[model samples]
Target: MVAPSPYQIVKKLKVSRVLVFRTAQRYRRLGTSDDMQRRGRPVTVTTPEAVKAVREKIRRNPARSMRKMAKEYKMSQGSIRTIVKDKLKMIPYHGSHLTTLFIDEKIFTVEANKNGQNDRIIATDYQSACEKGKILNKTSHPASVMVFAGITADGKTPLIFVDPGVKGVALGQFSLRKPIMDLPARRRPRSSRQRDSRVVSRQFSEFISAVDWPASSPDLNPMDYAVWIYLTEKVSSKNYPSIKALKTALIKKWDEIDDDHLRAVIDAYPKRLKAAIKAKGGRFENYS
Candidate 1:
């Protein structure tokens, strides 16, 4: 039988006519279809060592500029950029300035008012205390302290200080155990929202029993509406040279917060929940 024509092969094999013809010609001439080494300059800069070095630098500081990296690595800026973009698959991002209002505004309301009248829902969060002058002016390396605290309907808990640059397992080990253990079992409300980090901790589920709350309802949290705002205002009014000084001032101000004021804030939860429901999980106008 005669061999099929290239057109017939193209139709039968569902391949391009050019590819079929090329394959036939190559097989007749070279007796194999493997790719031959073509004449071109070999790659020099994108070596395995260079890739490892580039990855290490990026791991060390994600925000490091491509120009700075090129200067340090003695490679062309274009080469460094290619490594970052194509080889490393990283895109440079200017960090966003996040605010509570922005987050609360985005949260879609969930059905979370099963026991609307219960006063056991606690609220917890992290607040950064830095010199207000430096923050306002946007100048020099500003020292800050990450303060973790919570509030119940009755009153506030003692302030917890998380060390700078600590997260994940380190955060779990350094900060979570004490405050959770110290919480009076009587006041350990049936449910609470302590932000994503606290919720994700390995020990969190073990100590704090499983309780669900609407992810987007910070407006419902007394800590966000009353505690943090008040603390931030009080802390910002003074200046501190170091985090230690800032922490001392924070503890002082926290102690000064009257139980009456705290109770009032806690009592406002029902109204906030009602407002949240009225708005269908959007930002409540009454939140202050």
Candidate 2:
């Protein structure tokens, strides 16, 4: 194939004039535009020793800032960031700066929730996983485990498995307390709509009657709109043999989730609320 001229390359790539000139100059001198070493001070700051030091510091305190580490090590924040991110493959999650804690409950059954798109399976041509009996069927009554959890910008709470047939009055005994200052916003779909409404109403009837909460505002709840769906997708990839197995998998995956993701979910709250307002608090899921 004929190599494109510099003008053609510039037009096709739409790169800056300076970059095109530099590439052309390099190619003329070295017969290749690929990276070539230039004479400069060798990078000694992000050495193996520095990387090990940074990794240990982060392990001790994941919430430590690059600025603080840089000041302590007498290195630039840029170098610290590079060591933390490129060298260690770690995401810089914002610390416990935000105080709001979003909490919710979800039930996991032995049979995964296989609805519409989630039911589709990948397989050979004209021979899908469904044909091989990989798909799970819906059950009228499946063994289930209900989990209660909370998340903030910092991290998540330990998964609390609710006992079978536990009522709202009994839920208070779980002692949902964390050391962090939090404005707890609990959104319980099952208990709110079906079973525990009466019990919950009896306990806080004034609060229920006084506040005109949106009747169907899942978009307003972070857990309802994001966290639960994410967890369900991760946990329900296959049918669990028993509730015990499902709970174990849930715990494993839940703990594996990093604070970066939790922080991002919390950060999107304002945008979701704005979209909700634009939709007049009705079916805002499709707004953005």
For all predictions, the C-alpha RMSD in Å is 22.7, 24.5
Q: What lDDT tens digits, residue by residue, belong to model 1 across residues 1-288?
A: 998888899999999988998888888888898655568987689777899999998899888889998999898999998898889898888784221111111110111112324423333422232221222332344555566666555445577776556653554444545554465765454444344555556645545433655566545566667777777667765456666677777789888987688667766667888887888887767744
Give RMSD (Å) of candidate 2 vs. truth.
Answer: 24.5
Candidate 1 local distance difference test against the native: 0.63
Instruction: Report, for every candidate in turn, its global Cα lDDT versus the true structure.
Output: 0.63, 0.74
Q: After superposition, how far is residue 61 of candidate 2 from its true place, in Å?
A: 36
lDDT of 2: 0.74
Worst 10 residues of 1 by lDDT: 101-110
Error of 1 at 86 (Å): 80
> What is the C-alpha lDDT profile of model 2 across 1-288, one tens digit per residue?
997887888899999878998988988889998967868998789999999998999889888888999999999999998998898998886543436666677888878677655455667854576585555587799888888877777666678888878775455434344312232343212122223556568777565542577576556667777788888889987789988899999988888888788778888888888877887777765421
Judging by lDDT against the true structure, name the best candidate.
Answer: 2
**Which pairs clash (backbone N, Cα, C closer than 3 Å) in model 1?**
none
Query: What's the residue-level lDDT of 162 in candidate 2?
Result: 86
